[model samples]
Target: MTALRSRVAETARVYRLHPPRVSLGRVVATPGALDVVRDHGVDLPGLLRRHASGDWGDVCAADAQANDLAADPACPARLLSAYDTAGGRLWVLTEADRSATTVLLPSEY
Candidate 1:
């Protein structure tokens, strides 16, 4: 457990050193997402931090590649990240224009 915690801490440090590639603009959460977070004690900010830092969480390879491309200022595409939580799955999306970021359950989307 200590080793696992150490690895997690090291990973977090790496992400912290890397700045967000795009602006989150306005952050909003759906009611369902809020309920899920509340029910499961989700760490919303930590998830968002990972998304912003390009961690991409549990996304598929193709989606991860798309997110990588989207990170490039010249090739802006929408950014999507999926994370599995105790409640279920949460998704975070940042628009291509960087106008907003939304947090929602897949059912809400």
Candidate 2:
């Protein structure tokens, strides 16, 4: 966890985006999400760096009007929905202030 957090901080520095407090979605602990993470060798920190640097794999939408970017019941604001190299759909949601980020599968959303 410490390593992951450090990587995220490094990423933020490189991208010049606000350093985000990162956490895995609750669903990530489920078997399904874990399987995908394992199978795809999901480099969370690397993915986050890519996302912050605007290397979005496939952007679904960006909503600046929403107040809460991480917990919106509906569409998440500043959403970066993309498929990983393994063809798994992943969603990265960042807070309006860019102070936090949550990574989850689309189904978890």
Candidate 3:
């Protein structure tokens, strides 16, 4: 398998073995996110996995200045952000129960 896919699989396996403190939410892609997937050929699920795993940095409390991944440190993130290797930024918002997550580009918000 490709390295990226392998990493994703490994991350998934780790999560399966020991889930995070907060349950992972269902991942959905917005229209603009789909467009980004088409344009940048990103593995959206992998990106989401990385974010869910807290592999991302640069946390911000507010949606503003979210050109990159940002999350509130105090609370379980209602939202998470990350950037792909190609420099594409993505934002993920989780439901109150953390049962659902929506992935979108920064500009889409």
Per-residue C-alpha lDDT of model 1 across residues 2-109, encoded as one tens digit per residue? 774565466678778888767888999999999999998887887788898899988999999999999898999899999877788999999999989999988887
Task: Note the residue pairs that clash in candidate 2.
Answer: none
Tens-place lDDT digits, model 2, residues 1-109? 5775566456546665534333223312345555677887776666765655454545534532222243343543444535354537676666544455666677877
lDDT of 3 by residue, 2-87 (tens): 88567656766775554333445677788888888888777676666656665442345454334223343344436565554343
Q: Candidate 2 regions off by >4 Å?
A: 1-34, 60-81
On TM-score, who's better, 2 or 3?
3
- Candidate models: Cα lDDT each: 0.87, 0.53, 0.60
Best by TM-score: 1
Candidate achieving higher lDDT, 1 or 2: 1
lDDT accuracy of residue 101 in candidate 3: 80
lDDT of 1: 0.87
Better of 2 and 3 by lDDT: 3
Question: lDDT of model 1 at residue 17?
Answer: 89
What's the residue-level lDDT of 25 in candidate 1? Answer: 85
